[model samples]
Target: MKLRLIIIFVILAVPNAWAGSQSQAEPQHEPAEIIKFAKDVEKYAASKGARAFIIARMGRPEKDLPDGIMFTHTAIAVYSNITLNSGEVLQGYAIHNLYQTAGSPDKSELVVDYPVDFFWGAHELKAGIVIPDTQLQQKLIALIAAGNDQALHNPKYSVIANPFNSQFQNCTEYTLDLINAAIYDTLDIARLKANAAAHFSPQRVNTSRVKLMFGSMLMDDVTTKDHKGKVYTTTFTTIGKYLQKNQLADEFLTLNSKGEIQSL
Candidate 1:
């Protein structure tokens, strides 16, 4: 499960690639203080090399910020929309991001799905997470258009961490939801065609390139996604409608702070 979600995370990491921020103009921050903190995070992700997509969001919290400790925190959404050296872009997206809080003075963690997809890969992509579930989508639209920030921030609307922490300055009770694909570079086109025969459905799709198919699987405890190691009453169970495309970047999706598609 972890591997699957991780791979998808990388592909989804690119969209809306990590958002950029201009330093705070409100309060005068010391020049040295800002530079050192900035270097720490840049160094952290830089150590990961050039392949992984690293998106970092730095900002202060709206509630309960610590003293003496700089309030800005970093969440690294690492992604890898890897395309082989075919000299051509692959038809789909990939994902594998893990968020990290890389600031000073004692409070940091690697949030699995915070902030949003930074594009398709490290340095080159930052569009957003791409999602296929229609049901999950409608709910997001309603929440964003619900008119008031306080209302949208209602516990009932929380589905994932606000990837754009700048918009919604708070942690959430919701966990990120995902979807992704595995690319096959099988040699035998004949074998691939034969496999497509079994799953292909008469279901006409708007997608081009691959044969379409259908099936259903039981999500035994998907409702438990929000359990977080302990049970809590939740109306937040995710209902997934899964499907695959012959050619499309596979990725995870969640509602960003503004409830826009976090991964595009």
Candidate 2:
């Protein structure tokens, strides 16, 4: 009975231990500080004439993240004309994301939010910015504008989703699928998976087999069935590396709260 109780405790706490994509209940930093950092990220992207770019945020503390994991959540930001509640039309960036459903981490939904809202629950005021080549950027903007982004979404959420398959998807994997759809000019899931397997290299999840096994058994969002051998998944850094390796990115960088820029 005692061993069973200890197992229950570990199962209940596995989600927090693995740290999947989820929004925070409260702001980690001051509201003003978050807003400023978010705006700074936008300004930096806009200054580079990035009509559409991939953005990432740290949903968990950097120290707590396992090795090779950098950011927890990723989305696409497109420059557009935003209409506020006051009927004011402002030119800014709007973020498109695949967020896990609240209270149902196994499911996900496509959400459109702004940079401020994107960073509202961030654990750190750091941003991962990847501006694709101008041609790819135009393609991405056109694809999303044509409503293909939603067409490519798979609502089955997983924390360690295998990029080579469409069985389940995380935010980063969803973003990668969208990018590939634009690049290949097709919404065919099979073809996308093929291309991903051939061209893209995913980041391996650095955790023990025992923990993963237990997490998969207990957590609805954690699964290893999709992975054939070593557990691997799409991540913000891997996406950047993919774009860079293919010469599809104009700039891949990181922005901090202090307005510092560093290459990824």
Candidate 3:
């Protein structure tokens, strides 16, 4: 059941979507072989200065009926993110398709098989573990698992849209974004709320910027000049405004009534 709602994705499997460590040193692999070769390549990549490679699935329970055929399938989803030496980043995912076929042959029975496995070329066939920081990725995984369905709807936290269908757009990325938003937003807020004597304005227009731990996307803080070409109020919404390119994209532009600048 591919629901149309935004799913905070911890992981997903998408068409041709993958992120792998770029290693001229690592052994070469065919596109179709990536999934099956995950374990081996991950180890090899780790040895060759690649990041961590992980796999996760999503689905429901299997039900057995009177039929002799074994029919069991879950909404399968997978994700992979890796970092390179120069600090480049790649990420991708796909949704698992589980189903069965009736009357496969003359025999009176059904067969359990995936009719299709969603993947895309632009998304990479796999992801790397980001080898240097497994602990950080694991911590993020824990945070996402802790969030319930209700938590996904909150604006304060980056909404995890449908990862499987949203092209690996899981809540995991949103949560990561929020974490960054908090860091950058808080730093900016500190400057905005400083006393007049401690006031330090941005030297250039729209120079204040925010970045992510992985450098996936750069969400710019709202900034402009006054009629006199002076940097005026640099409003900050909260410390953590949830960093989605669209949702809280304009986050740092606004301020709460309290004027303390909320921190996520």
Best by lDDT: 2
Q: What C-alpha lDDT, on a 0 to 100 scale, does residue 245 get in candidate 2? A: 99
* Order of candidate numbers by lDDT, starting with the best: 2, 1, 3
Q: Encode model 3's per-residue lDDT on 126-163: one tens digit a residue.
A: 22121213443344344334532123222221111221
Per-residue lDDT for 200 in model 1?
A: 29
* Clashing residue pairs in candidate 2 (N, C-alpha, C atoms within 3 angstroms): none
What is candidate 2's lDDT per residue for 196-217, written digit by digit as tens? 9999999987776677788888
Model 1 per-residue lDDT tens digits across residues 1-264: 996775454333321111222111232244444434334433333343322221223232323222221112222132223355786653221222222223311111222331222221122111222332344333333322342212222122211222222121112111121111011223233443344333322211121111111000121111222223322210111111122343222333333232244432
Q: Give me the runs in candidate 2 sitting further than 4 Å from their true place.
A: 1-20
RMSD of each: 21.0, 1.9, 21.8
Model 3 regions lying over 4 Å from their true place: 1-31, 36-135, 148-175, 178-264
- Stretches of candidate 1 exceeding 4 Å from the true structure: 1-28, 53-58, 61-264
For residue 45, give model 1's deviation from the true position in Å.
Answer: 1.9
Global Cα lDDT for candidate 3: 0.23
lDDT of all predictions: 0.25, 0.89, 0.23
Count backbone clashes in candidate 3.
41
